[model samples]
Target: MIINGVSVGPYQLGWRLQELEEKISISGFVEEELDKHYTITTNTLKFWVEKEQGEITQITVFGEYEGKFLGKIGVGNRLSDLNDLDIKWIKEDYVYKLPDYPGICFELEDIDDWDELLAPIEFISIYCS
Candidate 1:
């Protein structure tokens, strides 16, 4: 299913996962003293495509098992951090434009805890001509 122009499920563009336990640690919801859980995830991919009127498409993916913690999060977070390591400007044809390049964006569980550590994450939006 598609929600807010973002895709869902295995074929979607977004995901959240943790290979090891206690890595993407999440507290506050585990007051019940839960033990363990399983999670899988992917990064955010926002790119532009010819949608008849220059529409932007974004995709996100995430999944996890439930164990009664933090009210249940679809996917565990590695400290709720995101990264945009390698990025480059996207060209419509042969020219580059402002606001049309890849940018770093962070999706934090709590904006209050978001800091420089999350700088690696970002979002890329298309600039209007």
Candidate 2:
């Protein structure tokens, strides 16, 4: 089957919708990226993210399938799957909402890695605020 993303296509939205295993997960290829992203409704691009300030990264979730709830989990599933299940966003404050077509994305923040741990600790604190 073909795969489609906010960026990738072929299957586009239709094929992606089929990947839903009653659950779906969005994981970052790198630790510095937004680790978690999920939607509460169809056509809803808003997603909640797991943020890392220090050496940590990503805000993620694991969703499961339930016929009645029509909910989707992140565990044991891939971002490429969506057909069999509806996105069930875990309720949170940092809900990621997309403002543009395809979706609103983040501009990765730049940082300098220091040999000392203090730099990371201080950086994480700033984000926590």
Candidate 3:
């Protein structure tokens, strides 16, 4: 999917972090840990980038913006909403996993005392490594 006009995924492996910052308007900072990480954020969306040896190792996204994740079906939506789009999802634990897109998932949030037949997305995650 596209984030700020830059395509991201396993294909984006090896892309430089500077390239993303220049291409996208999102704001973030690099953090030091076992591996270096850059976190980009909008009001509701967060993009995580991991680098090892100065090259991108993985990218992940999380948020609820415009009822989509990276412009694909995810977040800010109910589980039933995807039915209209004819997308397949698997519920495991509290996350809805998309089989069509590997390494992509949406976490569910409880809005009421009891779990509704339809659940709202709390966040979406796209893992690329």
Candidate 4:
């Protein structure tokens, strides 16, 4: 999977909900709605999409996703793996973000142990900066 600030794999931020549905259909993936977001599930990946006015505003990847963000960071990577970057924690969401990189954030398995080197990432969220 190729991930950038604006996109995850082929799913780009700001894509229309209909466009995403078409791609999901072509890939034979299943989609489900939960609360305010929609989830797309494939055999090895699960991602959530939140939209506004029919356009995707955020894309969050979790649950067995095997791809890396920017081919470097990923769900299983430890918190220490990001030590070289300027990472900030968002208390309200229990997620971390890099000040230099907009539109992306990471959720760890244990937010309380966020400073622990072994804390593993649980989710990767991409959105509009």
lDDT of 3: 0.57
Q: What is the C-alpha lDDT of each candidate?
A: 0.27, 0.22, 0.57, 0.71
User: Compared with the true structure, what per-residue lDDT tens digits does model 4 show for residues 20-69?
Assistant: 87877856778788787787776644556674456677777877777787
**Model 4 bad stretches (over 4 Å):** 2-4, 26-52, 84-93, 111-115
Which candidate would rank higher by lDDT, 1 or 2? Answer: 1
> Evaluated with lDDT, which candidate comes out highest?
4
Candidate of highest TM-score: 4
Once model 1 is optimally superposed onto the true structure by TM-score, how far is the C-alpha of residue 17 displaced, in angstroms?
A: 26
Local distance difference test, candidate 2: 0.22
lDDT of 3 by residue, 14-58 (tens): 567676566455454444444366665555545556655454544
Give the Å shift of residue 85 in candidate 2: 36
Give per-model CA RMSD. Answer: 16.1, 18.0, 4.7, 3.4
Q: Where in model 1 is the C-alpha error above 4 Å?
A: 1-56, 63-104, 111-129
* lDDT score, candidate 2, position 80: 25
Q: TM-score, each model?
A: 0.21, 0.17, 0.60, 0.73
TM-score ranking from best candidate downward: 4, 3, 1, 2
